[model samples]
Target: MDFDHIAEKKQEQKATVWLNLWSNRSPELLSMQLAKKHRPGETVSACLWKSGAFNICYRVRYKDGPDVILRFAALGRAILRREKVQNEVPEVFGSGICWAGPYIVMSFLEGMPLSQLLKDPSREGRPVLNPQISNRSLKRAYREMAMLILELSKHEFNSIGALEENKRGIFIARRPLTFNMNELMVSANLPEKQRDSVSSEEDCRKKFTARCLFLNITKELCAEHSQGPFRLYCDDFRPSNVLIDLSTSRVSGVIDWEFTYAAPAEFTYVAPWWLLLQSPEDWESDLNQFLIRYFPRLRTFLEVLCNYENKLIEQQLLSESQRLSPRMEHSMETGLFWVCLAARYSSMFDEIYWTFIDSQYYGTFTSLDDRIQLLDQEQQHEMNELVKLKTDQSTEGKESFTDHYPIDKLLEL
Candidate 1:
């Protein structure tokens, strides 16, 4: 991706009113646009998180009293508009969902991003932390995060006027299709040997067939098993979207709920952990600590919460399986259908794929060789079997997967 170009596009696409609104309007004038009352001469100081992709956030402060964070929608206007019309924004904000939005104005939260503490040694972006902070401090941060996740899981909302109530709302809950590991392999821009092995003609056919089946199964399941009375929120839950106080090491508040959806509770439980770009190791380590220290009294509560989420997932799957057209159910149970669908949705696939394969960002689970070995035994086997069922008996097509650009090229962005 062209970072400069993308950044330029982002700036251009950001709502003009948002970019200039605060700059042009003094605090007195801007206060008129806000529903909340403010005192005279309140100064608004704005600082943007340049690394964010979906929303533009500004930190606003008053000479007296507290600070507030204002977030404006950055991309996908239709989705944003729908969220606004449905009143999903207020619901999500009230429920404390993270990382979903069009625009939100909230109280400015104190403390720093965890990235400040865990700066990458190879990168010069952020300053490194003092080693003396101790392992206990790190664990405390993670434990706090876990408690926040647990807390958010309990809040829920119903779909009152979502864009596609039947298809998109939480009331009509369905398991989101799983991430496609193959596309991830392709997008990682790996070596030719690795790419060639995974993108064979047989692999594509299997993926396509499997995707067809999964959708069918999912449709059937929704028809049969979807229960009424569900809650949903902007589903993007990540640490960057949270604010934490260094002194307290507790989550001050959760921010960003633009993509919030009303669905089965499981959707919220798993959404926070899907950023293939972030290392699971770091998350597990950090969150484990946060959970331990922050919610020491609530350890038993975690299991009950997880069980509730699992129950929803189980019901959704069972209902979908029972209603599935033979073809659909077959595809879903096998995992081929979801992978192929991911390939067709190239943009989504690419974003998620990059997350999994971008070892620099997310760090590999093991060596490349080890990952490939596992892939062959697991992912490759599933894809191969599906392809055999979907394609011509005589000829198997083969293609190499290579990154469109190298790491150096990506860094230049």
Candidate 2:
């Protein structure tokens, strides 16, 4: 599809909105003037907040009226369709959280983003770091997010058949796809001659082979258990997606479910760490604290949760086993195969990095020797240093508090 055309259309729409909004007066002074119009009894003043990247948000309030937020969807029909699909997904509305379609209109959540909170060094502005965040305030936030995901998982769609029948296909599709690095070698605006130094097709093929090998290895490791299927929200699920009340560093609501799906249970379990951009250092710094705070008595709770998740997967798999096809089998082996296929074809490297890595790790690496050798001495040295750092960290003494969740539990099985 003509993504450039789509992007250009979106830009035109954005420009039109900007023109209309600023046609008569200075936009800068508008919000302040509007807020001044608020009367003593007014709950809020109607004003636009231009913080979101994709949507325009307006905060509206009136005397004795609850403050409300209205978001205007900015993208074209495709985005609207995706939003509609997301809205149809039961868990979002089932959580007793009301959102008005894809263009969200809801009561204004009264808190700052976690990003803002972290910027504040003071305890009042930061999240309360404790053994257990019993502050009734924090509980609501965390519980609400967790509950939303739980409810989403409870509502299943048969588009891909039951879990057992489509386990391999689901697993394969779930594996992240990577973008073609070769396209990035040439700037879109650059002259053809200027990009002559770009590698040959053979060279590109080698790199692809190496990546496939990595994916193969990862797949082998992930599929060893053959448990069952569950659901996943493959996109961001970080603290930034949550709103925590300022008075209590607790989560008030969960936002963003654009990438939700039903997949392997393992995918969901590792989501928290994955979203945090898991690294050895991150694990060391927050694993214990997270477990202690979020899953107190981690062993029992983790076991129960894992068991429940696994059971669901098994149930889904069994239900769909009879209709499994060879192509589907290959897809299942790869996890979210169709999605991965689309990502691979998109040619957008940034979008497909994870998926590419997954597939590359699983495919082949024999052709990568040349590319591997081509790496500059400094890059090789850096890789060595990273390996050493990881090895040393793992060998070091264990912390008094450690995550009860197993490493395998974090994989997208």
Q: Which candidate is the best by TM-score?
A: 1
Taking the tens digit of each residue's C-alpha lDDT, what string does model 2 give over 1-413? 11232233433554464446443554334432333333233444557763443444567665676555544443321232223233322121111111112344445567666544333244452233332333443333444444445544444333321122243443222222111111121122111112121134443334344344434444564473235544444344555556777776566765544334454434443323322222222233333354343333232233434444455558773223222223233443444442343233333322233333433433442444544564557655665554444344334442321322122221110
- Model 1, position 95, has a per-residue lDDT of 18
lDDT of 1: 0.39
lDDT of 1 by residue, 279-330 (tens): 2322333343533432332332333334444554576633332221233234
In model 2, the worst 10-residue window by lDDT is: 177-186
Best by lDDT: 1
Name the TM-score of candidate 1.
0.45
Instruction: Go through the candidates in order and give each one's C-alpha lDDT.
Output: 0.39, 0.38
Per-model TM-score, in order, reads 0.45, 0.43
The segments of candidate 2 whose C-alpha lies over 4 angstroms from its true place after superposition are 1-45, 76-102, 120-199, 210-228, 232-234, 271-413
